[model samples]
Target: ENNEVVYELLADMGWTGDSIDLDSWLPVYCKARYGGCPAAMDSAWQQFRETVYSSLYSYPRFTWQTVVPDTRRISKLDVSDSFLQGVELFLSCADSLESSPLYVNDAIEYASYYLAAKADDCYKRALKEDSLGNRVAAMQQLDRSVEILLDVDKLLASHPLYRLEEWVDMARDWGKTDLEKDAYEANAKRLITTWGGFQEDYAARFWSGLIKDYYIPRMKLYFSEQRADLDRWEENWIKAPWHNTSTSFEDPLQSAIKLVERYKGE
Candidate 1:
């Protein structure tokens, strides 16, 4: 009976038949059951989703950089209009689930919310550290932001509901024979193109190369010199060659594929 209930809960999350990994889910199921029956599990899921949504939407449209006086110097990079729009779109998509369900499996949505919130928190901490003139601490927070945001694709690839490789493999297989693209193929291409295209306003990212090679180094350059003129320092830094090169800009779909491939090899 307990096993049956666990399976039923998995079914609710769209995992069915042999696709359900009981071993991976048993601990979560047991923990959920400790509170009560199936209702407990359902309530827990709802609470988790709600918490993620709330955290994501709690920040203003332009975020902490705009609100905080100290961060105004680097406000453009810290909270760009493009970054805010991407975040808004992400949050909006998550919120839409409340009124209209789209996907059969919402694990990807949950992961997206969790990752975006985590990245935002890291960015806020970085700004706080910068305001305090603690370059080392600020870089640490920025590193965390990179880690969190870059892991989003990994989460999607591994999660049962949104198996990135599986979808890619299936799409490739179908493309080999089918002249007409299916809905899944079309949707997948659209998501990749839309998120990965030249339009920077739609996609948000803090990938590994951009962080370690770019943002961290850029911050180092900022802190290397001791300047009395805060305004001049900021102005000079923004105009610096490294600053323009180190900006957080990349193809999201390509990054996702690279990470997915790395995961597969590992």
Candidate 2:
């Protein structure tokens, strides 16, 4: 259960049968991890369960995270009201949850997801603007999308679990020599970026350094009509020196509060 963590896989073996009653599981999991669960958080988790624990989503990413900035992707889900309500309820308890690493990390994670949804909206709007021949308007929307992604990267930096620097640093630590360190670091970057043919973004993650370093530039190149040497450009980045500077907000809870109020229900 711990290793093969996906319940969907267990369903086929009749181990899960179907949904594993999150109502019963969440409170216990919360206690084990955070010592206690607030009523608001439980209600928020129930609201979120409609989107997360309710289904077996095949893709872990949104349309904006695709290899190219195409808006035709099937996983383009509209942000649901339940998800927004959950976010509101979750943020309402920020004062209570701020001290717990697990809670703070969850706040960062949830905020990042909401921001990604907002970014996808901008992405879709950009494409629509382009279709209407509004080049300047389209670029504005595209630029806004990029801004949101950078914000996401910043938000995720405060999170221990989702930060790209954490992954890359662990890769570097696995090496006994400088050459091996460079190789391992390159592998780590590649796994998140060009994870090989036909699977370039199958497991796309919106991590801190990854968003600014990889996705930001990819979106620009896609918009600039520079399709010729994109693959080589990615290779260059993979083999390049590890010089990405990690960044984060000092008070992630307050940062989250500002972010939520700024783009609430957008």
Candidate 3:
């Protein structure tokens, strides 16, 4: 039963069936290491952690405590500045669109929402201590996430899914006699204006709500150490003159951090 439960948990976490049965004793392991379990299932997880630690750290010089660094020094995520900037950019554009505005405006508004959501997600990830790093890196990743969201948003807004003729036809249908004359005019005008403004608005957004509840508090391990910035970082990393034979000096963590930084830079 213990083995089965362990296997099931692992499978749920995306582990293949080939791994060991470490689930049943997890809570015990947790208690021994982390003091206690918040829930019944955690008991098994605690035990499993101990088992793995014992197996992996049995060497004379190995120390489990040292391997997983004492997390006491880990500070709370300080993504306020970067997150604020991202949210500001995201919401400023998002809040301006009226509902049923021109199709182009709608597209731009939708893209803005998408970008904001992504930025929020990145900020939350940066706050996760288990997955977080130095302040600079965290800020950088947050910025990068926003920039990508904005760029892609604008790109999507500019290249609308439908052509101008299709949009005009749609506006006409919505502007029929049943609709108020003012309503028709307003809707038609909005649609037309949006056709041009979509490119300008790109990823516009409404105001951002407060920054609380943006990230998971306890489950920090799910956050990423890699920079969220892909385009610029990849360009630099791949094209660097010194990247030829120095795998030892290749810092994936730093590269990821740099990407996030560059994202904020723009």
The best candidate in terms of TM-score: 2
Model 2: per-residue Cα lDDT at residue 45? 79
Better of 1 and 2 by TM-score: 2
Q: Judge candidate 1 at residue 40 and give its lDDT.
A: 31
Q: List the residue pairs that clash in candidate 2.
A: none
Relative to the true structure, candidate 3 reaches a TM of 0.21
Q: Count the backbone clashes (under 3 Å) in each candidate.
A: 0, 0, 30
Q: Which candidate comes out best when scored by lDDT?
A: 2
Q: Looking at model 3, how many pairs of residues clash?
A: 30
**Candidate 2 lDDT tens digits, 111-163:** 77887888888887887887798989989989988888888888888876676
Q: Could you give candidate 1's per-residue lDDT for residues 1-266 as a string of tens digits? A: 11244365557577444465544564455344332223333443444434322233222222221222233122222232333333333333322232322221232333344454555567677778888989899878767665654565344433333333444346546564444334445454334222333431122222222233323343334434542443444344323222111122153333333433333211
Off by over 4 Å in 1: 1-37, 45-105, 158-266
Superposed Cα RMSD, model 3: 23.2
What are the runs in model 3 whose C-alpha is more than 4 Å off? 1-101, 129-133, 149-266
C-alpha RMSD in Å of predicted model 2 compared with the true structure: 3.6
User: Over the stretch 1-266, how does candidate 3's per-residue lDDT look in tens digits?
Assistant: 11233454555568455554555445444344334434422432343334322332211110110112233333222233444343333223322322223322333433333344455556554455225557666556555554544343333333334223333345446644744433543454333222233231111123211011011111122233433443333233222221111011132222222334454433
1 versus 3: better lDDT goes to: 1
The alpha-carbon RMSD values of the candidates against the true structure, listed in the order shown, are 15.9, 3.6, 23.2
